[model samples]
Target: MDPYLLNAPWVNTLRLVLEVAATVAFALSGVMAAARKRLDAVGVCVVAFVAAFGGGTLRDLLLDQRPFFWIRHTEFVWGILALCIGAMLFMRQRHFEPTERAMLLPDAIGLGLFAAVGVDIATAIGMPPIISVMMGVTTGVFGGVLRDVLCNEVPQAFSDHRPYALCAFAGGWADVALRQVQAPDWAPLVACVVLTAGLRGLAVWRNWELPAWRV
Candidate 1:
């Protein structure tokens, strides 16, 4: 089966849909972070843009795609810019708070989407399974890692509290295994998204963590 279902007449349509879903979720999360930092308009745009493009850009770079998604998907860039503006205006009206809580959902969703796509794209280019897995994990977590650095917070994925990257890594490997099973293309995609989202949700709900790194 073709890795992309919409590699059909509706390919562009599906791409637009996936791109928008990931873009909006990531843009909002980044905007929320910038709001907490009391960033100005430019800072808000920068943060939102980085968050929105971070995962995809990293995926493209690793895949050796020149120009990146943001370059080709100019509308995606504009959409995040608009969203950042709106979110900043809205934050001005309410007492917006920054909690680890807000980032969880978007991060999880983005992780699933990015991870699945990373594998698909890598596989399309004939990358080995292990490389695809690495690309998937990198595409999933590197954004939030960069986001934390920008926000001056210790990266949550690398820390004990949430273990977000660990969840993503497990899911990406699961995704690769699923594909190698030759079940269906959708099998890997569905499994990747479900496993990542489910694990992230569990971590958030139960406050799960890896055992404390040695004292």
Candidate 2:
């Protein structure tokens, strides 16, 4: 039996917690975007649902996992619905305007958390380290991509180029390295989350950007 599988119970718990956190953060991001676009209630819910589950759905499909996470945990759907309703009500009451800059923090947080979860899942499934890292990047950025595309904007992962996927790649490798060294299972997850989020935050704060290619 794989040691990763042996540590399943606790690891699974951590995964669940991380998944919820990621889902909420991404959902908020989507809601903010929808609000900025002046979308109606139903549109807000649609965007929130896609942002919350898009990446995980793609990840599970690639891994051949049945009954995608959101499907298995139907409560997540209700949670997102409640969250959207509450957030909209609050924003309207306060006359709050959702700005692009305001969306960065939650989006970054979700990216980090989902990246860590992706690496964890792929590792547990006995994927190679490189593949696990790729999975991490994919899980981190895919939802944001879907959200942006739906909003008719270029995805941040493609256009912003402020070390988004690069951060996830680095963090995923860190997680894999820690696991290889017999670190506690939770350590890798925590470390990766911090690294990915911290890097993303720093990138935003410092106006970091990949050099643009000119024709």
Each model's lDDT comes to 0.75, 0.86
Which residue segments of model 1 deviate by more than 4 Å? 1-6, 9-16
Candidate 2 overall Cα lDDT vs. reference? 0.86
Tens digit of lDDT per residue, candidate 2, span 52-135?
888878888899878888888999999999999999999978988777787778777788899998888898799999989888
- Count of clashing residue pairs in every prediction: 0, 0
Name the lDDT value of residue 145 in candidate 2. Answer: 81
Q: What is the lDDT, from 0 to 100, of the residue 136 in candidate 2? A: 90
Measured with C-alpha atoms, the lDDT of residue 164 in candidate 2 is 86
Residue-level lDDT of model 1, residues 1-215, one tens digit each, is 56366376564464456567767777777777777778889878887888777877888876788888888868877778778777777777887676766667876877787777777678768788888888888777777677778888887568756667767677888888886777654577778878988998888788886787677
Model 1 / residue 131 / CA error / Å? 1.3
